[model samples]
Target: MVSYEGINNARPKTWATAADEWHALAKYSLDAAKDLREYGAKPLKDNWTDEVGATAAAEFAKLADQLEAAYDILLSVNMVADGMTTTIETAHSTMRAAVDLATQYGLEIGVDGTVTGPPPRSRTEAEEMGPYRAQVQDLVDQAVEQVTAADRLAAAEFAELAGQTGLTDPGKALNDLQTHASHVQMQMLANDIPVDEDPTTVRQWWNGLTDRQRKDMMLAQPVALANLDGIPADVRRELRGNGKYDRVKVVEYALANWDKGDPTDFGNNCTNFVSNALLHAGMKEKTSIWGTSDDDSWMIGNRTGVDGVDKRLAYSDSWAAAENNQNFMLEHGGSEVPRSDVKPGDII
Candidate 1:
């Protein structure tokens, strides 16, 4: 029979660590229980004592139950830890990408002499600031999208693994993963080390724009106005009236106006507009928009005649695994976008 005393003494320091240990223990327990059953049955031919046989049978049954419980705990702990690891790795990658981008754009240093390696260099002259700010903002926006995508992938994988492990209650496993991922993401956002661009500086620069300059900038990009169907009518109107909206303001508008109908239904018009804006600004063709909802439309869909098709809906039941389907979009150039190089339709 399996040794209950040994098993009880083998408890781990933490639930996750314990789960790992019990996973191995559970397999060993099952093997031991099987051996005991076989040995007990073989002695039937000898007509063993009733008390001894009953004890053996009861012990084996108890071991089997214990093994099953241990297996469940193992699955739950693994799922939670896996989710946490994925989120942490994704956040680190995003921060690195942003920093790299900033360095490329010459924004590697702050006015106070602090090193901010990845953003583009600041444009000292007012005339040179707008485009430079826009470029930097675009890179930041892309980084945010990538981070969000990573979060979603982590969540989905955790859920799938939990189901595969034959856990008695997979819902708890999924919830734990979600909580862990959220906590990691929140920590990353809170740090705000300014990898690609500084939010405060960008805001100040935007506030300095002249009405005419803003109007000219707004009028230059027909793509954003025409294609962003997901944008609210009022916000779209505001954008149309003055092209000088700051990068953050535009993103805020997009987020605020996001349609909630379908979780994965990336709205057609608005996504295209955002994608096109990035393309015009020299962002790589693979750059995508990332968000939690179905309609947030980054680059995961198939395009037809310059418009993206709803592949999720079109192939609902036949969807490929996420890892096999979507290519991770890494930042191409350095973090900061220079003001002079900023295209009118640029996202940031």
Candidate 2:
């Protein structure tokens, strides 16, 4: 749990800086060990066949490999440090803002993250402080959630990154070391996300993350995240890589443009908003085929009016109505999933 006083006094950047220094030193040592292998060990093993020279070269190679394993451990430590720094900074700032808001609204917050109503002279004043106190409590809770999640994730990551095990193959000794860095990055993303499936909550979680944190999650589990709603279009694009219709982009665009339609949609309607997002994400549009019933096709037709500044828009029911759009997508290779299987980008 995060407290007001803890948030005020915590220095996450200091921890991150210390970790970086240690990483730099470890990298330097790793480079030196590599140098030993190349210049000291390899040359001796290649040219000196005598028993003493060969034994010394073998020892140099073994010591260099051990140094590499240590370096790998330090590399994982630096990764965790950076992740913790971002998490702590975000939580601290969130808690501080809550406190500031409480002060602005005539509420009092204690060091233990308890929000209290202001001393009101009248019943009306007391009633007015209720919302302010609630807001402060929300922020405090958010900070605690963020920090507690980080604490749990960091513990697991440290254990995995620094675990010692028996090594049977000398050649495979560096394999675990080589893979730890990327695995540690994925571990950094194993945080507590909201289970309520609120789009706003999910988006807030995504936005609060640092770039490295975002990228690591993106690279580690792009497909799963691509299905997550509330992620931005560009990140989803990077996740998909291919030029297919991105479900993440579709959801993002629909939510952002629901009330007011963009030029691409040309209709200030809910179905139009969703269709625009689908088209923008590379879903092909269908034209009128049979008679021009709104349900006969799924397409947006735009035209210029006599007054050039004024434009007119045409749409089929499938493109402008919710029920029709649902039917259209269902007929076009989309299957409905159970609530437990719902992803961020699901149409529902």
Candidate 3:
């Protein structure tokens, strides 16, 4: 019964704090386990001789096992809490973004995940609103259902470990066998996740993973995970999509197109050249249709079409002036890198 309002209001910071606490507990447990082995278990095994000594050794070994179990239990809790923090944050950000898009289209998502469009005055208005309503509904529904599943999946996992004492006695032989079997099981799961699969297939597989498995798989196979599509939308947004920003293309365009022989290139055209390189590097044009064109309009405006109208008035101000271009970049996917950290093919 989780809803739009629940995710929208959830505090990710608190989850982060909880994760930190669990990590601290795990560290303490690990220290205790290590201490038991070093100061207690080892010494007992090394010196224990005959009947009484052997009896004492057996009891101490059991204690060592319990301490190791305690460390493992705490570590598992820490890992889950850490992973859940990321999951909850992603859910919150995605849900809020969906809500914002819904609002943008004059639609409202109810607390129970219902999409309500604004009342339309005419049949034409109703027709226009239909697609937007459907889009928002799909987005909101997917976001809600995915997050709910993740939450419940994590809850179910936690339930299995509930009330189990971190430091408890368990007489066992399957412990070592269990560990090996679990490793094999996890490896099998990892192998089952297809490599170089179509993005749709990859996304579907990723969506089916529990939150724990997602975190574990990412840690275990980062290179494969990096190649896969459908990473968290917020993380993906930070990247220029599909490796579109190619430095090689930027350099190539710069070398081939650098010239003042054209009539439009009267004098300095550093930003113009940069804009051309950027276009070759796959930066999309933001003409008046999209934005960054308040002064005048030029069809297919940029360096390639700079000669069509007045040179100063022909192109995007962002496509010509260094300052304007920098500002536009900052507003877009670009970041203000420090001078010392600036790399080649980066806008100066």
Would you estimate the TM-scores of all the predictions? Answer: 0.30, 0.55, 0.50
Which candidate leads the pack in TM-score? Answer: 2
Score residue 232 of candidate 3 by CA lDDT: 59
- Model 2, stretches more than 4 Å misplaced? 119-131, 159-244, 247-348
In candidate 1, position 221 carries an lDDT of: 35
What is the overall TM-score of model 3 with all chains considered together? 0.50
RMSD of each: 19.6, 15.9, 19.2
List residue ranges in candidate 1 displaced over 4 A. 1-52, 108-348
Compare candidates 2 and 3 on TM-score and give the better one.
2
Model 3 clash pairs are none
- Cα lDDT of candidate 3 equals 0.59
Error of 2 at 215 (Å): 9.5
What global local distance difference test value does model 2 have? 0.65
**CA lDDT scores, all candidates in order:** 0.40, 0.65, 0.59
lDDT tens per residue, model 2, 1-348: 555576667788797897788689679868977998999899999999899999999988877776666666666677677767766776665565676777788778787878986478898987877766776676677777766776676677677656643322334434664355545544444443332345554565566556665765664455546667777777767665443377656655654665663554434456666677788777887776552254657786653433222223355668757887899888877778898655444567
Q: Which stretches of candidate 3 lie over 4 Å from their true place?
A: 163-348
Judged by TM-score relative to the true structure, which candidate is superior, 1 or 2? 2
- Where is the poorest 10-residue window by lDDT in model 1? 1-10
lDDT of 1: 0.40
Evaluation by lDDT, superior candidate among 2 and 3? 2
